[model samples]
Target: MLELLLIACLASPVGMVIEEPPKHEAAKVEHPKPEKKRPSVAVPEEPPTAKEKAAPVPKSTPKPKPAPPAIDTKRLAEAEARAKRLTSENAKLQEALARKELPTGGEIRNPAEALAELREGNRRFVEGHRIRSLLASQDPDLRQTLTKGQAPFAVIVTCSDSRLMDNYIFDQELGRLFTIREAGNCPDTQGVASVEYAVEHLGSKVVVVLGHTACGAIKAVAEANGKPLPGNLWSFQAAMSGLLETTHEDPNETAAEHLRHLERNNAVRQAQVVLDRSEIVRHLVSIGKVKVLPAVYDLATGQVLFLELPKPAKAGESAHH
Candidate 1:
């Protein structure tokens, strides 16, 4: 029985006795390990070529030019024509002046024609007739023509007396007469040269030595009566005295009559002196190119009494006419 109980106890759940593990002897577990990594490096670039380094260039623009001005052909032609016309007019005027045409239209060609002109003019003067030539001298055109040159018809050697009007008495204008005046109408050296120039160069036709009835010079010399005159008048007195000595005196003639005779004789004597002193005058007179005469002007009567008249040159003589 005991054995049977023992067997049952061992087989029963609670009746068995088990052994336990010690506290100090526990269980151990293992884990996996971490991995290590390496660092990264940078790379360098290559240089550029010549063709990739150059840049492109830009182009420039040009400007336009201006046009020329227009010409006026019609105006230029008109101006040229006007200039030509003015030049032609000036030439014509110069040619007319060269021909010696008087503006009054009277022409003097020769000495004879000049003498005839003077005679006709004197006649007209005495008759109080007015001719166109004398009246036209006041015209400006005629005066301008006279300025070009002078052609006197006659030359008169007369006294310086205020009463003697050569222009009025002869009916002459500014250029018609060449007159030489002195106290006694005497031709000294200078006066002779002037007469010669007129005859030789100016073509004077006639020369007259005119004395008056009551000439103061003749009276003064007569009163001197062989005595020397005062100052430079002695030269004139000597000349008059020489002329008087040669003059014939009537014994019964009154003093006034003698003086008048001397006056007339002095006129004739001075006229002769002109002929003797100037060879040019003598030659002209001989050839009938010019005539020299002696005359006395009666102050009271206004009449000219010619003491001597010039005869015409002989035939075959060298007369210019």
Candidate 2:
């Protein structure tokens, strides 16, 4: 009976279902569904407030520009024309000056040439080659020609000594030198006026204050020693007021030497006096239109020594000294 029971247990019952245990099936691999995209819609901005709309927008300020300079065409043209004319005249003058030739009729227009002519004439006179002036005096037509008009080139302020003849000393003919004579060669007011006339009207280019060696007038003044001279000659002391102070007598030098010094100083002083008293002379000298020089003439040698001129005074200076 036990054997039959075992065999029946081993045998499968007919129409019995045998179901397998539920497998894990990889957790069913659950894939998530794709997310759907929604259509986009733009949101409108908020409208400006009434106060902001009514307010004005600030603008940048532009810088102001300067105006252009005005041009005067007529004045510009006149200036250009004047410059050209002056340039042309200057070129012509330079050409004339370079040649060193005297113009027609042996006339000198400028101061340098006038001074040179005087020097050459003096040289001729000293060297005994003075021939032109001799013939000039003899010429009949020369005097008549001079009568028409005179254009003296030099004005001579010289002593009235009998031996000191400026025409013979410089070998200049008539109308060539306008001469003024005083006892001491010191120019007074009238003498200065004569110089003004010569320079301004006659166009004389050189004014020479000429002194000389062995001058009697200088000796008289020196010997007088501030004492009033006898007769009308006392005016000479007044004219030569500061001469003694300017030229102190040297103990080592002879009395004659001191007189010579006084003579030369007087010449220089007179030249300065002319410049101080006469504005016309000062202006011409300053502009180079004329020259005022002091010269010493040797009575024995007949030679002229031109002294160095003093420097011009500054403007507004009342006196030259």
lDDT of each: 0.63, 0.72
Q: Which candidate wins on TM-score?
A: 2
For 110-165, candidate 1 gives per-residue lDDT tens digits of 55666566666555556554232343313455467677766666788888888877
Error of 1 at 225 (Å): 1.7
Off by over 4 Å in 1: 1-98, 102-120, 126-139, 309-321
RMSD of 1: 58.5
RMSD of 2: 47.8
lDDT by residue for model 2 over 1-321, one digit each (tens)?
Answer: 222122222211211111321133222222333332332335235334554455575665654544544656665564445334333433443354356432112447698898898898788689765533644323454455456567789999999999898888887767788999998998889999999999999889999999999888888888899999999888888888888888867799987788888888888888888888899999998899999999999999999998866665666353224
Instruction: Tell me model 1's lDDT, rounded to 2 decimals.
Output: 0.63
- Prediction 2 global C-alpha lDDT: 0.72
TM-scores for candidates 1 onward, in order: 0.59, 0.65
Q: How displaced is residue 114 in candidate 2, in Å?
A: 0.9
Candidate number with greatest lDDT: 2
